[model samples]
Target: MGFSTTHLIIFLVIIIVIFGTKKLRNIGSDLGGAVKGFKDGMKDGTDRAADASAAPAQQVGTAGTAAKETIDVEAKTKV
Candidate 1:
């Protein structure tokens, strides 16, 4: 035996009778929101990995403002 269009039509009718049209629409919208949230979470995870890989080159107290602070302190100690 083979499935045909009539079988699908009857199944659809049964679904509509059981759930009504409004409930089906709400279910579709909720499924769409869940898919969107999953995609956004995947993107955030990739961005965090990239930031972590590039973190070691930028030292906090090894140059620029920190170096000036060390020099100033040494000069003050001699006065």
Candidate 2:
């Protein structure tokens, strides 16, 4: 048979007993925070994507901070 409201309540009570209310509250807060952060990151990503599409592509010849981050190296073959 499918679970009734009473069965769900009993299950919740058991979980609360095992975990304790303080621990359950902390877990709930942490899970909520994680979900909030995930939502924020997704929104930021979409905003960045829209901005990128609206802006013109930068020229490769001129480098900004990206230039400073790169290192030029000559590859050598061992004899």
Tens-place lDDT digits, model 2, residues 55-76: 6556444457688877666554
Which candidate number would show the highest TM-score if scored against the true structure?
1
TM per candidate: 0.68, 0.67
Q: Write down the lDDT of every candidate, Cα atoms only.
A: 0.86, 0.88
Per candidate, the number of residue pairs that clash is: 0, 0
Worst ten in a row by lDDT for model 2: 54-63
Clashing pairs in 2: none
Candidate 1 residue 69 Cα shift, in angstroms, is 6.0
Whole-model lDDT for model 2 versus the true structure? 0.88
